[model samples]
Target: MGIQTIPGYMTRGIVVNGHGQRFINEDVYPGLVGIEALYRQGMDVWVVLDEEAFEDVPEAERWGLQPPHVAETVAELEKGMGLPEGAAVGGDGAAVFTLGGLATDDEGRVRDRDGGPIAGPYAAGRASSGLHGGGYISGTSLGPGTCFGRRAGCAAAGAQQ
Candidate 1:
C-alpha cells in the first residue's frame, strides 16, 4: 500500500503471525516489514496493538481494510478474529514490490564489476538501483524512476551518436 498505511504498522505494537508468534522487529522500515511478511509469514500477519496504540491511528490511515476487531483483552480479540488463542492482531499487505535493482551511474548507464559504466546499455526506475538500498519508503520510487528514466534515454541516445 501507500505511505498512508505507515502509521498502522509503525504503531506502539508488535507484528505477529497467525499463531500469535512475533516475527520481524516492528521498528524497521515498512519495506523490511513487507519482506518479512512475504517470506516468513506469507503475508499471514497481524499488528498487535494495545488500546492506546490502536486509538493513536487515525481513520484515514487504516487504508479501507475491514474495521479492526476490538475486545476487552488480547485473548478475546484473538478469539473473535479466529486466530490461535494468542494471536491477537493484524493487517493485509496490499503489495510488495521489488526493493533493489541493478547498479547504475548518474546518467543511468549500468555499472560493471569494475564500477565503470557499460557501453550502449542504460537502465532506470525499479530496473536500476538509482537510490533505493536495503529499505524502502513509499513515493521514493516514482520520482527516481522518472528522473533516471529520462537520464537513461538521453545517455542511450548520446551513446548511439
Candidate 2:
C-alpha cells in the first residue's frame, strides 16, 4: 500500500489542536495549510461542528458517513473533545494528517519551484498539486485526477513525438 495523505475536513466548526488552541484560520485556509498548522501543534486534533454546521451538510454527502458527534454549543463540544477550558472556537471545519505528494503544473506536468516542467514525466490524482489552490473542498479528489490525468496523458503523448 502507498502512503496516504489524510486531509483535515470540516464543513462548519472550530478546529483545535491537542493543546486546545487554534493554529490556523479555519475559514481562510482549510486544506493543506490548516493541516500543516495542526501538525505543528501535535498529532491529536479535533474539529467541533455545532448542530447548525452539521445540518448544512448535503444529504447526498452524508449518505455513507456516520452521523457526527455534536453538541449544542462550542464549549460543550470542546469539553467532549478534551480541549482546554475557554479555548477559542470558530466556524465549521475538521482536519486529518496525510502525506504530501509531488508538485505539478497546470498541465499536470511535474515541475520545479521555478515553474519549469520536468521532462518525460507527469503525475495526477493524489500526487498532483495544481488543482486546489488553498483549501481542498470535499468531492474534489477524484475530479482533479480525472481532469488532469487526461491532460497529462496528452502531454506525455505529445512529448514522445
Candidate 3:
C-alpha cells in the first residue's frame, strides 16, 4: 500500500538537519515538500507515490488518495507501478498515459485523466504478493489473503486450551 495525504501518511525519507519531522514542522506536510526537497537532503526516492486530495472530503465521497504534487502526474507515476510509459492496456483501454491522477466525471466512476485510479476505486497494490511460502515481508499490508492458514491453526490451538 502507498501513502495518502491524511494526518499520518506513511513516509520513508531521510531526516536532515532542517527538515520537518511531522511534529515540529509548521507546514501542512512535515517532511520534504517535493522531489527537490527530498533530493536536497541527499536522499533519492525510488518512487514518490502518495495519496492526495487529503482534504475535508467525506469518507463515502472519497475515492482514493490524490497525487500530492502537480508534477507527480500519471505519466510520471507509472514507473512506480511497474508499468511502461504511455501504456495502452488494461485500466483505461488501449491508450493510457499516466497512472496517477483521479479523473472522474459527475458520477466519480471514470479513470482519472492520467489513467490513475479514481477516488473510492479499489486498486491492486503495485507490488508483488508472492512470498517464499506465502509470508509477508516489509512492505505488504495485512490484507485478506496474506494470512489465513496460520491464523486458523493458531485459533484452533488456542480454542483447545
Off by more than 4 A, model 1? 1-5, 59-66, 86-161
Clashes of 3: 8
Clashes in each model (backbone N, CA, C under 3 Å)? Answer: 2, 12, 8
lDDT of 3 by residue, 62-153 (tens): 45655444345656544444446654223411111111123333222335546654544432221212222222254443452245334434
Off by over 4 Å in 3: 1-56, 59-71, 88-161
Question: C-alpha displacement of 105 in model 1, angstroms?
Answer: 29
- Tens digit of per-residue lDDT, candidate 1, span 36-151: 67776777777666777766667677666433567887678788656886443355333334444467989998899689988767888877753444556677779888988998
Candidate ranking under TM-score, highest first, comes to 1, 2, 3
Global Cα lDDT for candidate 1: 0.66
At residue 30, candidate 1 shows an lDDT of 68
TM-score of 3: 0.17
Q: List the global CA lDDT of all models.
A: 0.66, 0.59, 0.33
Superposition error at 26 for model 2 (Å) = 2.5
Could you tell me every candidate's TM-score relative to the true structure?
0.46, 0.41, 0.17
**Better-scoring candidate (TM-score), 1 or 3:** 1
